[model samples]
Each structure stands twice: as C-alpha cells, then as structure tokens.
Target: MWCRIRRRTALPRKLKTVPTTTAPNSFPCSTAANCGKKVLDYAFQRGLMHPEDMGPMTHWYSPTPRVFLEHFKPEFMVQSSNNYDHPEQQVWDCDDEKNVEHYMELTRAHIKHYGKGELFHMIGLAEWVFGSPEENLATKIRVMKTFIRHLRREYPDAPLLIASWDFMFRWKAPEVRKLLAELDPADTVILDYTTDSGSYSNNFVNWNLPHHFPWIFGIFQAYEPQNDLFFNFDRAEEMYIPVQDDPMCRGMVIWSENSHSNPLLEYLAKRSVDEPFSLGQFCANHCGDRAAAMEGLWEIRINFSIFFRKST
Candidate 1:
C-alpha cells in the first residue's frame, strides 16, 4: 500500500501559493555534536550567512531521550507545587490528558523562549513524539492535534514546523492522512526525508496531502563514529535540483550526527546561501579548480568507503 504512494505523480511545479511568512533557508545542526558553534563560526567566516538563516538556532529532535522536553517541564508548569528540581526523574505519559497538558505548557514555554526575531516561532523537531511506546497512534495524533491547536492560539503568527520521516508511507496505522489534512497549511511546515534515504528523491514529499502545506527537504550528511558512508554529492545534486527549483519547497536542512563534516557542511552551506545545485561553484570555491574539486570529492568518497570497510 505504501509502495503505491511512491508511485504517485510528483507535485506540480506551480504549487499553491505559499504564505509570505515562510522561512527561506535553514541549516540544521541539531544532530551534530558540539559543532553548532563551529558551524556558526564557519558560516560567519565565509560571509555565507543571511539575516534570515535559522541554522544557528534550529533544534534537532527525535522521540526517545527527550532531554529538551523533559527539562522544560518544571520551568513551564503553572502550578508552583508541580515544579521538580530533577526534571529527569519525571516521567511524562502521553496517553494521559493531564500529562499531555503539561507537555503543551512546556511547548508554550519553549516557544516563548526561542520564538522571536525574524522567524517568530521556535522550530520544533517533533516526529518521534507523535508515536512512541507510551502512546498509541490515536492518542499520539490526538495529542499532536491538540498541541498544535494550543500553539496556534498562543502564537498565531509563528510558523509551526513539524518534523517527520516518510509520514505518508510510514504513518498508515490508524490513518493520520485525515488528521493531517485538517491542519492549516499556512502555518504548518513539514520537514521530510533523512540521510538514510539518500536525501531528497522524487517521492520525498507526500503528494497525497494538501498542496499548500510548506515542505522542507532534509539532507542528512554525516553521523557519529565517523562512518565512511555519507551523502553522495553527485546523487545529492540530482535529487535536490528539482527541489531547489520547486515552488512548494520552503528550503532544505543540512544535518550531521556528532561532529562537523567539512565536505557535507560546505556542500549545504553553498547550496543554501551561495547557489542551488551549484556543484561546480562549490568545488571551485573549496578546491580552487574544477579538476582539483573533482579529485577532492573522489578522495572523500574513497576515504569514506575505506573507513566503513575496515570498521565492518
């Protein structure tokens, strides 16, 4: 059934009109370890930054080990007695209405702290929270819907970014299509794709959903433990070119696991700020010549392969 979704027609080039409030570009360093500062430094040094770039503040999120969400609990609780010195000791059950309310409060606090400046809302990495062990599909979706509603009420002007994997294909349990269909397209932005899937593909965006929903293509380039298998620059170029040209695409996200990988970092930085699908320019800037750049890219691939081969 999910396979049929992959076969659906690609989204039309002339997508529905995007809201004027949409963000143009973002560099996500959430998964990268201690490298956020480094990425910012590099961007500043190269003059690749724009006043609108959210790379410096974008939060990387997953379901388990919800450190940020946990820490936010005590600080946002309305009841003074609910405060806990050790928030890590607290357990949040999504299935419970009271707990979910607390979660919403925490989300509000997060938005208040991070939501300011040009973007106006905190970028949330919220895919995993929708379906984890404690919450069933129905409960998770219900919680998310409620949370989004509250978010809209408190911060109507803020754009909501909901991060997810291949949601159309993977989230078929109780059928979230209808639930997602009901969301306001203008305020909702979906971040799709992952490094494991080799960046953006023709079927990356879920065409089955509303055409007006803003979509951001993700580019996961590096991981921890220094594996050699990374995003194929040539293939990445092929996949993202259409995305770059697509009107529906809000922007792209570049991520790494633990440490900053220069090759992938440079690739996305240039693509986001300098030019889209400009591999030649990227190579020229980094290697000083097209031939040298080609050689350098080849060397990175070879090194990646060798590193993985030995590790295995």
Candidate 2:
C-alpha cells in the first residue's frame, strides 16, 4: 500500500507591493450613504444622526482647541463660535513662538484624525483681524499670510477653506477679498453671509449684524472657485429656509447644538411629516459647560447593537 508518495505541496509567499497614491474624488456626494442626511432633514424631519457624526467626530461639535479641524468631514457640519480657545484665560501667552509650535503639533494630530480638506464656516468674529477696519485689515492680511505659510509647510496637499467674515463684511470686504485672491491657487477659502433680511431676529436663528449682506453678496457673485465656498448655519432655521431662493447656495455650515437652540426645528417637528424633533436642552453656543451633564441626565438612547460585541 505504498500510496504514490504524495509530494509535499509548497504554498507560495504573497508579494508585498508599495501603495499607490490617487487623487480624491471632487464630487464625493453621489449615494445617500455618502451624502448622509441633508440639513433640511435635520431641520424638518428631526432624523437620527449618522454614526460618523456621533462617533470619533463628536469633537467637531465641541468648542475647544484643535477642535476647529474636527469639522473637516466631507459632509456638512455646523458650529456655534469660531473661537479656537479662550486664549485670554491661558496662564501663559499662546501667541508666543514656543506655544504656537506646541499647539501646531496638536493641530497636526487633529488634521490626521479629521480629514484635512474639509471646509469650516464659523461665526462670531468676521474679518480675520482685530480692531478697526483700517488697522485690522493690514494686521489680518499679515496674520493670514503667516497662518497660510504654516499650513502650507505642514499640509501642502490639504486645503484650508475659510469664510473670513460673514457678519462684518460691511467694514471689511474689499481688502478681505484681495487677500483671499492672493491665497495659493489650490487653497480653499470663501467668505459667506445670510441672505435673508429676517435673519437679524427670531428666537431660533439670529443674525444680529445687518447692513453687511450687500457687501457679502457682491463677493459671492464675483467669487471664483480658486477657494472654497461655505454657508454658516448658526441660525439654520432662518438661513436654510431662505437659501433655496438663491441660485448660489452651494455648501452648508451648520452649528446647532441643542434642539432648543433652533426654534425652527421645534416648529418643523410639530408640523412636518418626518420624525419628531426632541425638545432637548442643547445650547449650540455653550454646550461645553453642560455636555457631560446632559449626556448623563438625558439618554440619546440610540441602538448600539452593531457597534458592540457580545460577551461570552
């Protein structure tokens, strides 16, 4: 029974190859999964939040340092304030070279975790400079150049899209536009504003600064895509409803923290055909003070079956 001696078959080793680089798709929004939920859905339907928004990217919804980069997801996200950190509350000055370098390292970590090419439309401070228009213009230009210089060195391939000043355009449009034009051709940046006159007041969304929309409109009309375009949804209820009227409504910048922060959401939930919006204690502007408390006291109560592993 000397069965024909079976020759030991040898398994071949897998070959290792270097990874190839490919450019990112410009229009990454085709399927519903990729597009996720639209802002109108969030407003009108009171829909459930997507996993990515609530997962590791939750930091994008918070107000803190290095958090500015968290909104870099390909889809739309809104934030309350553009304030990076309370630099005023710092024990040691952060503007110093050493401190800036340290923070820059932290900034790199944020970009690594969050997509680097995402656009951020923020409110509160318009005109990248401080002080009067005349003095601030020059200083803002210099600061922008320095900031861009740093970004170029670290993230040469990534783009930094910014809306310089949505509210202060009346005072700082011309110079701001010029500076934006001078930015690297590949850099993504755009200034934005609320087009509706009613945005100035209302319980849900408020745009306190008036008389600046004209200047902002002019810039938007003339803007070329050498940079990015963003829409700040600080008061989304008022902004999104009116934005459908404008032909140039391209990108959305939303910053609603709590359901209460947006009165329109409440209205839509009560009347709309979609999901009901929760009357939660979510203050979009200052959730940092009470985020932990809210999480503990109130249950978001979403399913975690897929995300969890069964214990043996």
* Most accurate candidate by lDDT: 1
- For this target, which candidate reaches the highest TM-score against the unseen true structure? 1
lDDT of 2 at 145: 58
TM-score of each predicted structure versus truth: 0.53, 0.36
Error of 2 at 18 (Å): 40
CA lDDT, candidate 2, residue 247: 37
Model 1 TM-score on a 0 to 1 scale: 0.53
Q: Could you give candidate 1's per-residue lDDT for residues 1-312 as a string of tens digits? A: 001110111212222121222124743323332253355456557755312112112112212123344333423211122323233423354445665454454333322322122232222222223334334355545646755666666657666655554353345423445545666778766665453343233245434322445777666554553333334566666566557556777877765654656767676777777455444555566666465757566667756765776687
RMSD of every candidate to native, in Å, equals: 14.3, 20.4
Report residue 265 deviation for candidate 2 (angstroms).
5.2
Angstrom error at residue 140, model 2: 1.5
How does residue 40 of candidate 1 score in lDDT? 42
lDDT of 2 by residue, 1-312 (tens): 001100111111211122222237643222322232233234335532211111111121222222222322122122133433343212122234443443344344333332232322222123223455665555445544555566567557654444433334433334544554566544443434333222242211232212212112211212221111111223233344544344333333322223232433343344233343332434333367775655443332211211232221
